[model samples]
Target: MIRSTFVRTALCALLAPTLSCNMLDVNDNEDVSGRGARVFDPYQSSDSGAIRLSLQQFNGCAILPSGSAVSKGTLNLPGYPDTCPDLLAADPTSARSAPTGTLRLMAGTRYFLNQLTLSDIVLNKHTNGADLTDAVRWMKNESRFRNLDWSDLGRVSDQWTFSTGIEGFSQDAWTREVLFDNARWRTVKDDTFTVEIIDQDGVTPRMTPVVYSRTDFLADSAYGGHTRVGWRMETVQAPQSPGDVVPHPLPVLSGQPASPPAYRTLVKIEMVGSTNPFKTFEAPFIPGPAILKVTWSQLPDEPFFFPIELVTPEGLAPTCANADGQPVACGFGVDPKFKFSTPANGQGYYEPGESFRLFLDMRDGDGNQMLPAGVLPSGKDMLADKANGLLYATQASYFTLLERDSLPAYMVAGPLQKLQVRSDPQAKAPYWSANAESVGLVDSLATLSAFPGVYGSTWTTRYSVNLPQDAEPGTYVALVKTQRYFLGERVAKTNSYFFQVGQQEPTTYPNAVGNCQLCHRGVLSLDNLRHGLGVDHVEACKTCHQRDSDLVPRIQTLIHQLHNSSPRYTQNKTDCTVCHLTKESALRPSMNVCQSCHPSVHGDEYFATQFSAKGEPNRFGNCAQTCHAQSTTNGHILPEN
Candidate 1:
């Protein structure tokens, strides 16, 4: 009985040690104190607690539930020698296929512990057979690995192997299109291990599948160099599950019909402001990411490419708040949303009816600044003058903004006094001629005479006329000449109206024809030259003539000399009869004689006469002779004479 007790005691001693060893191993593997399982605490610090929990949660449960096996799995990955020599250098060149390896995984595990000892793992030379440098430099400068947080992983030793705890997870096979390559994959297995390969070019080493446990569950995870690498835990059925059921529905067919595309709403803005005659408001345009539609009137015909930018109120002068209560820039092309800096010495904004004076800083599409004169300048005031003074005869001349397929519409603004005229004249009585000669009138007198039908009361007229009691009873002609102002000078001339007058006999003379002082109230005389004479006497031969009967001949000669001497009045020295007739005869009423008195009025040469120098006496020549004839002259000269 004592011997049996001894044998039992010895057996108990042997079993006691074995039992203690078992308990220690179980404590190391099981999740205790609510700490996560499968988390290898190499540093064993409070800071690692969160990382431990995350890893365990991601893997579903700890790999070794209390009292499990301690043997860990071995992972061997195949390396492509030709394409990736750094990983597959040990393999023979003839073996184009990857070098196969094995991973010894303990059965029924959620996570695995692997000691990647530096001495056990070997880094192959790169394609150029260059040795790998510092891993930190590779992670930072290499494109592929630049985004990876290297501090999160273990450090690289002289042997370049990293010791880590990997969570075992499964993924369904997925196909991905390789960038810049046509090689497609039908299916791949989920990989259990990962390693970074450094290239000789110092590029970030790409992490490729080294070992995949389930080929059917693997996915093609190739991505561009910039793609981020991360992992997520998924609860997938074990490969050895009992049921034969499809896990997820096949991905919905690609290229399915989609809804029609939608378009963005566009807002249109119109800027209105006063303009000056001397400056142009280059209408400002505001640009944004959205498509812009600009609408304006009084703009140039061509599209004005301008530099557009957002601006604050302080940066833009003459700015005012728009309807939306936002400050808008003023001046030519001032867009409310945009700020503009004009050229140096710019006159800035201009008010309507004010002299325009702003100059724009021109630019090209590339935003290169240009000089004002190189494009358009304020000094060239043509555009401003046109905008302020001229009316567009056609709708097209007005400014407009139109869509690609739309018809152009006109703007509503225009210059003042669109159409202007200078004067109106009354017709002569008793066989009156539309020609100016018959009326014995010159210049425009309709304005001064206050003639009812001659000068309309709406605008000012330069002159008006009155007739004398001794004026001829025959028909006389009247004339009105006008000059248009442009750039401080007359640029155009026009004649407006012509009408007839009847004889009132001796009973009365029209008040308009009776008052010469109405138009000629201001007068100044210098020697024989009388300027500022009444409109009636402006060009009248009698204006300088006296009533002495003996002086009639002398007055005629004096009148001829005065016209001949004035350069502004005549082109050359010529005889009085060259433009006038001394007789009342029809054939003697020289058309040339009338032309001589109003030479410049006809502009250039006058038409030739049909009558000869000795033609039969006509009423025109007969009247001329009655006034100024040779005392010894015989009867009228015949054409045959």
Candidate 2:
């Protein structure tokens, strides 16, 4: 196979210099880039991740297809069904009532008690030849790898920042609170995620979890805001850990010729300063979750210095500049000082036929205040040199408000109704800047609006809006988007001001058993839902999801693809009852949503291929006429076990 791969590559290089070969990797059956691509030689790529049967291997024929045939197993998930039958029978009709009543809300952090995690993984690899030894399978927490304890290692934020330059965090431990999003706090106690390493030799080895913890793995401080920790790896020499901290047992990613999965986040950190930690290695670069993968032979080796890099969620890629062309400060946003003054977000309200006051005070890193429409700067100007072009310019800037269906805490926010834009500069109040000509919104709402100004060194603005009698009696969020020019680049920032209308009917978001913790082992990333939103309950998700989306699949289809590929589902598929609350009783009598996840039950080759290719299942729940076939076959009225 290796020789064959090379023959094709060699011929391509000689015959067409411009054409490169994408040789096939026999192990994973994936394409390996050649020459200009990753892997230059085919043999070198194949031998890197070669999964040969160990002469002392115990498990035989442990790969997909052969292993996938095993009966559907069950994980002891809390509040979820243990067996398929129990799940189908758990009725949620009584609890699935539409929110009838409501209550009032104030602005603040709505602490959500979310919990979830990855279930135990089931190893099912195929075995063709002999030489089977006790093969080891470890799902190392790629997110966490520690050396000495946290106290000894200190906090991640204590010394690390973007200014550390590239390779700043080469091989070090990151504090938990600073690294992991608040959503992931519950997943790790003392910044650790442990998965039992399974050695499935004979009859399924006892459940073993490979622990990923911080050097100072202990109870979170009662004072709050504790740090999560993990170590970085260098390839120069082996890794060395202090007496208290140690490395994880996960395998290392070798220089395989194949391109890793898109899910595998990799960054090539050019080593800076000294490679040896014992010498002087100030962990440069952004600190993130490391991918720890070691070879089968290197299990017992100490001072583990295998090359390491961080794994970031989709949008958190560490780049100097991002897709939007904006320069990246660290892995997130660029230079912009963020602060909110009066009428802070998640507060303020408007009732029908009633007027509400909207006051705003914001400032930029340059300490220039926000002026209303057409205001000029008074002090330090960062961008344009002209009167309006350089200073606090508001002629092109505006603030828009959306009539939301509900508050941001419980439902998909609006693209619903937009308030009228005030066209006049009749604003109330003073403003500040280097050039203070005149200021006000391009369009402003009625009543005591603030005129643009650059005086008193303040970015103050105000508005009074009177709601019509026919306005929807719901919630509204006013987003004040201000724009400025910094060094010839456009810089923008938005401030959210949430308010409710008359007779506010307050209700709690409905996220019972399907709490994220039940699935993610207690980590939920609410980045980029509805404009980077996160909701706690089902009712909130239904507002935008349960329906059609211009950019994403409907809730049903999205759920299928998300869970179907999740690590938890790979172990057991019957745990659907965990993240869902749709009662069987609530479902249409003639509808069976089971096909959403169990499309394989269709039995027909065409039906199987068609839907799987769609990357989702029958979300509308008309399996009866899917292909001139009934929802179920034979006498199986309910979903099969």
Compose the digit string of candidate 2's lDDT tens values, residues 1-641.
11223344344334432211221111211122111111111111112111010000001111110011011122221222222111001121111221111101111111110101111111122121111121111112221121122122222221111100112212211111112122233233344323221111212222232333332121132111122221221111111322212222223334422211111011110101111111111111223212111111112221111112222233332223333545332211111222222222223233455644444433333223322231323322211122122223221111000001111111112211222111111221111111111113322211111322432222224445545565555434334434332211122333333334542332122222233323222111121111222222222232333322112223444455446533334434554444444333122211123443453444443332222211234223334445424333332232222
Output the worst ten-in-a-row residue range by lDDT, candidate 2.
51-60
**Candidate 1 root-mean-square deviation in Å:** 51.7
Candidate 1 global TM-score: 0.15
Worst 10 residues of 1 by lDDT: 51-60
**Shift of residue 607 alpha carbon in model 1, Å:** 41
Q: In lDDT terms, which candidate is top?
A: 2
Per-model TM-score, in order, reads 0.15, 0.27
What is the alpha-carbon lDDT for the whole of candidate 1? 0.19
Q: What lDDT would each prediction earn against the true structure?
A: 0.19, 0.23
